[model samples]
Target: MAADLVSRVKTDPNFIELEAKRGAFGWTIAISMVVIYFAFIFMVAFFKDALSVQVYGVITLAFPLGILVLFSAFVLVGIYVVRANGEFDDLTKKIVEKAR
Candidate 1:
């Protein structure tokens, strides 16, 4: 069945194009996220003192805020994973079926 599907994909131009487009979009999102996250870290490191603020009317909050932002990136990645696995996986399955 797998071999049959592979043969069909090879013969189906639409399936091939959809697969390529999906791959490109996924990679683009991944790379953009990595670059933006690193840039945020670099910015925070360079401007820590400038951005620091007292919280609860006492403790400094700069470090905590930075950590929160970093943690939120992981949350964003989780969302990306859910969307990609749910939507993109379905799209790929459809393409494969059509190819087959």
Candidate 2:
């Protein structure tokens, strides 16, 4: 069965198109994520001093005590997960279906 599906995927133009579409979507997501992560790093470097703070006692000891840095990390992770599980996963599933 698996071999049959592989043979179809190799011979079918539609399956090939779906596979290429999936790859393009995956690459787009990856490149956007890399750009966004680097932009965050650049922002952090440019505004390091702004993030420096001495909070009341316990919070002061914690790293990235600033709200900006914490929220930035949270938003970045949220974006990554949403994109990965939503767009990329859907594309991959479609490609698999086409292959079969």
TM-scores of the candidates are 0.58, 0.44
Off by over 4 Å in 2: 1-5, 47-100
- Prediction RMSDs, each to the true structure: 3.8, 6.0
Candidate 2 residue 99 Cα shift, in angstroms, is: 7.6
Q: Give each model's whole-structure lDDT.
A: 0.71, 0.63
Write the residue-wise lDDT of candidate 1 on 1-100 in tens digits: 5887678777677666656766787787678778767776776779777556677576667666667667877876887788778776776787767763
Model 1 per-residue lDDT at 94: 78
lDDT of 2 by residue, 55-98 (tens): 66645322543355556667766766786687667766776787
Give the clash count for each candidate.
0, 0
How much is 26 displaced in model 1, in angstroms? 2.7
lDDT of 2: 0.63
What shift in Å separates residue 21 of candidate 1 from its native position after superposition? 6.2
